[model samples]
Target: MRRMIVLGLGALLFVFPFYYMFIGSLQAEPDTTVTSVLPDPGNLTLGNYAEINEKVNLGTSLLNSGIFTGGVIACTVVFGVLAGYALARLRFRGRGAVFGIVLLVQVVPFQLLLIPLYVLIVRGYGLADSHLGVILPFAINTTAVFVFRQFFLQLPNELFDAAHVDGAGELRVMWSVALPLVRPALLTVVLLTFIGPWNEFLWPFLITKQADMQPLAVSLANYISNVAGRAANPYGALLAGACVLAAPVIGLFIAFQRHFVSTDIGTGVKG
Candidate 1:
């Protein structure tokens, strides 16, 4: 009973902030000064959402987010899988050194690389104010590469041997034999990569000043600072933006939760 109480309390503690944000977002007025995190049932309204809609073109922002996140996921998957397969299965010169470099890159904070990356994307390449500019930098994620490499390594060597015996080239074997068994890793990387690019406001903000081209996070950030505070219910509008930003991420995780299990790519090999 004690354990159940603790678990329940922990769960509630984790969820209460989201609940508070949702409740505050629906209220007719901002609840910034209110001591209670719980909503007052009598005062609940959708007016804050309506107010936010009037101030920002949420539809455009959502579309931009789709484009940006989609591009990043696509590039991350293709290149990450290829690089990972090469590192895991292929024997090449300086392969260990290259892997070491990948690991080293992960230890460095993105903030440390931000200035140089910005200069290259903006001044060097002259790609400022462009979608390609925003998407290009995040295309190949090191974390995604690492995740794919680990998954590929878990694959049994016999699987590759069988494919090769059947006249399959390395690329064909990677695509046909290896990838099918690592669905979980793909989903994992997709979700991991999705969260970062989807929620990222800074790089996109720096790359493009045009509101139409900016993702939902950037637009919501701008609204929070510039327009949301000007509204009658600043806090409510702010929470509403948070809700909008969080909804898709929560939905994707829920949808993909079933696919998170490992398939043990070597199971067939041992059998």
Candidate 2:
């Protein structure tokens, strides 16, 4: 009973920030003090949401974010799966060297290449203020490839052998045999990839100066930095923007969270 109480308290502690943010977003007046945690019911209103929406155009920013995040997730999954399969299953002359290079790339931060990437995408490709340009640099994620490769490696070799004996090509074997057992890896990669681009502001801001093309992160950032202070209820307006930006990610995680369980890959092979 004592342990249960402790655990419940811990859970509440973790959830309080989100609860506070939601409640704060509904307030009609700015309240930054601790006493305002239990504000009067009369002060609650949806005006803050309306105000932030009017400024940011929540619908358009959300759509832009969806497109950008969706594209990155798609490209990351496809290329990551192919590259991971090659590294884990295929035997080639330079496989070790290639894998080493991938690991090396991970040690380097994306910021280091930002200048060159900007020049290549904007100057060379002439894709300024475009969704494709924003999506292109993040298309192939090395982290996702590493994750898929690790998961693929955990599978028993007998499954691949059986597929090969049955005259299945590499692609067929991967699709029918290998891919089914890596559900956890796919979900993990999607969630991980989703958070990065969804929360990313710097790169997107640099890529597109057009307000219509900007993602929610960039828009909310600009609002919080420049416009929120001028609002009637600055605290509520800022929280409202945060809630709007966070809602989809929270929803996506909730929807897919149940499928994050590990599969028993060893069951396919008879002992």
Query: Can you give the TM-score per candidate against the true fold?
Result: 0.87, 0.86
Residue range 110-169, candidate 1, lDDT tens digits:
777789989999999999878899999788888677778989999998889998999999
The per-model lDDT (C-alpha) reads: 0.82, 0.84
Q: What is the lDDT of residue 91 in candidate 2?
A: 94
Off by over 4 Å in 2: 1-15, 254-271
User: Compared with the true structure, what per-residue lDDT tens digits does model 2 show for residues 1-271?
Assistant: 9999999999999988988999899988777778777866988998989988999999999989999989998998999999999999999899999799878877777768899989999999998899999998888888777778989999999999999999999999999899999987787777767877887777898898788999999988888888877877888988999999988878877887774444422111111
For candidate 2, the C-alpha RMSD (Å) to the true structure equals 5.7
Q: Per-residue lDDT for 79 in model 2? A: 94
Count: clashes, candidate 1? 0
